[model samples]
Target: MTSILIADDHGIVREGLKRLLEAESDFEVCAEAADGREVLEQVERTHPDVVVLDVTMPRLGGLETLEHLRAAHPDVKVVLLSVHGEPPVVQSAAALGVHGYVLKNGCATEVVSAVRAVTEGGSYFSPSVARQLVEQLRAPRAEIPDPLGALSGREREVLKLIAEGLSAKEIGQQLSISAKTVEAHRTSLMRKLGVRKATELVRVAVRYGVIEV
Candidate 1:
């Protein structure tokens, strides 16, 4: 049997995935986790053959978790699940040695196929994701500016939160920083992006595909 671990912050998502995977005779839902910490704990306890991991979660993010898993549990295959199909995010996951990349909107069969392919020492990318990658590769290289590249990691985080409509206080609370620090990051983001207003900042983020619309 191919023992599987499902890691997603949403309880409903976990339950649905467990049910779907368990329905397959060769696949077993060995464990489920609500976040990255629980995912590591479950991996230690259950040692599942594959893990279906969500890219965004409450605690440690999926890419960071994947890095840890690659270093500590290289034997296990991982299929990243995400809502964002942005090239940068997908490329980062691919560079991290992810075995599969499946979008959240993909059909159940895609997820199953991803798991099966990864466990069999192959790789899979959702159809849309594959197309996007190919399109990027085929597009002519241009000296297009990268606004995100100028921002620090923390600045990027603040920008994403701001784009999501989170206030400085809320972003600080979520990131464990003070509101003042959040404000500082927000100001720095605006300066770096050369945006005079918050709305303009969000527009730049959306244009660069930093945050989904």
Candidate 2:
């Protein structure tokens, strides 16, 4: 049996996916998580063969969760389910070693097929996602600076908190750092991102998927 974990913030979505997968004799719904942190916890406990993870979640987003999973649970296959079919989002998931990219609006069968293919050491993409990727490849590529790469880990964390609308003191308390230090990091973040204001910083973070809209 292919034990699977379904991770999505919406309980209804999770329920629907579970019911759909349970209809197949070879698939078992071993676990379900409402957020990225819960997803990691469930993965550790259940050791599911495959995970159907949504893109946006509380605590941690799907892309960040995928990165952590890659480092810690390399054997587990991941099929990313998202509402987004944008090139940057799809390309980022692909770069993170996602086994499949299935748009949420695609037919339910596509999700099942993605899980099966990934479990079998192959890969899958929703038709629309595949077409976008293909078009991206066929188009003329331009060299673009990756602002995300310029950010350090702590800087990214600060950026996320800022995007979440936390004040410097609140961010410091959450991170166990002094408020002054938080301010320093904020300054550095602005400098690194080439933004002069907090609003611009938030915009960059959102654009790069550091925080959801």
The TM-score, computed over Cα atoms with residue i paired to residue i, of candidate 2 is 0.84
- Over the stretch 12-100, how does candidate 2's per-residue lDDT look in tens digits? 99999999999999999999999888999999999999999998676667877888899899999999999877666677787788999
TM-score against truth, every candidate? 0.71, 0.84
> What's model 2's lDDT at 131?
88
As for candidate 1, its clashing pairs are none
Instruction: Point out where model 1 deviates above 4 Å.
Output: 140-213
Best-fitting candidate, scored by TM-score: 2
| Model 1 residue 42 lDDT score | 97
Estimate the Cα RMSD of every predicted model relative to the unseen true structure.
Answer: 3.8, 2.6
Off by over 4 Å in 2: 138-158, 173-194, 207-213
lDDT tens per residue, model 1, 53-128: 9987545567667878988999999999988787767766766789999998879888999999998899999999
